[model samples]
Target: MNSVQEGRVALVTGAGSGIGAAVARKLAAQGAQVVRADITATDGGVVVDVADPRQVDELVAGLGRLDVVVHAAGVDDPRAKQRIADALEAGRPPEVTASLDAEAWRRVMSVNLDGTFHVLRAAVRAMVPRRAGTIVVVGSSSAFDAPAGYPHYAASKAGVHALAQAVAKEVIPFGVRINVVAPGPTDTGMAARTPAVLRQAFAGLPYATPEQIADVAVFLAGEESANVAGAVVLANGGRFTV
Candidate 1:
């Protein structure tokens, strides 16, 4: 709602929909020259996958002056999701090690962990030279709680949290800050795709709207959170305290 980001340049991954789209919109509305990058074309965003290093480089190069980076592109392991539903319906935690297929695990890790690294690496290259920028990575409550079966997703996000902390430490001397925002079960299409029972279980806990998470992200990207670095802000409304 404020114009703190006026003249800033922000690049948001997965901006085609859900929380990414919300963050992109929030940054733009706050007067940042938002480059809404994603894999799919949405109403007000550009299309680019953070997983591709070349694409990430191109996107940053096009920005001319990259000020902020919000890495939000990620995926859940499909096999784990299915197994979790079956296990929950049977009243037990799914045997992820036995049930999850390799492909599913690889897919989730590639998009969530590797993709995050790609985006952050590109952002760093673009920002370090100018010695000014911020990076807000989108982690998840699951990274802390790590629900029963989604090991791949949890592991990837955990890596994200760690990476953010490391980045913050390594880049502070360059006048760059890196942080993470872990949102709870938000009302989004991604949440809708979760099994109904799983959704209900998460719903029973505190949940925030996409806008709320966006607010936290924007704060991390702005000078308002200047003292905040190597920190992970849990936006999960008390669901998971990490």
Candidate 2:
């Protein structure tokens, strides 16, 4: 892909670590003026929680002119998986769904699904007036293949894909291009915490580096994806068939 021109304003959420950080640095290297954000990031970006619609709105408003938006902020707390694993270890009947905590379920849905909605909502509003923009939502393979213990995570991701698809249709006609990058189990800290039994579902699949996914995000965020909208591009190493 050609180098993204300098001075292009870009905002990347969850930029404190993982794929979000990688994408922020990548866009910077490509000469775009990036606004890196997270709950806590040392890169001078103000703390912003994607789950809060007000925070998302204010962040976009501060940018003024948004050329690109990459929403990577989402939660994958390990405690729920650990709890299910513990229950199985303690000889309790493996009630996979019952083992998940109600609070955790709500929290995951809020941050993963609702959070994506808030970011996209704000981004669409910002991009619509300009009549040109690119949005790459970092989703997950969990939407298609739910693991044994992470029902909430899986469900939330599914919702993200649906929301992105729906929003893309509404905004594409207005020159706002929105797409999703649903990566498989990449070599992220969250993947490391998955229990063996649950992770077995993704066995034989090679993990991808955060930077690799960042590369894909950079592609979708640039003019290269001009004709692409409401698309879900998988960056997995041949793990999923579709």
User: Who wins the TM-score comparison?
Assistant: 1
Cα RMSD, model 2: 2.3
Candidate 2 Cα outliers beyond 4 Å, as residue runs? 84-94, 196-203
Model 2's number of clashes is 0
- Candidate 2 lDDT, 1-242, residue by residue in tens: 64664779999999988899999999999999889889875567879988889998998998889999999988886787776677667867445676566888889998999999999999988999889899999999878877666788889998999999999999988999999999997877677777775566467876899999999989999887788899998888888767
TM-scores vs. true structure, each candidate: 0.95, 0.92
Number of the top candidate by lDDT?
A: 2
Worst 10 residues of 2 by lDDT: 91-100
What is the TM-score of candidate 1? 0.95
Error of 1 at 9 (Å): 1.2
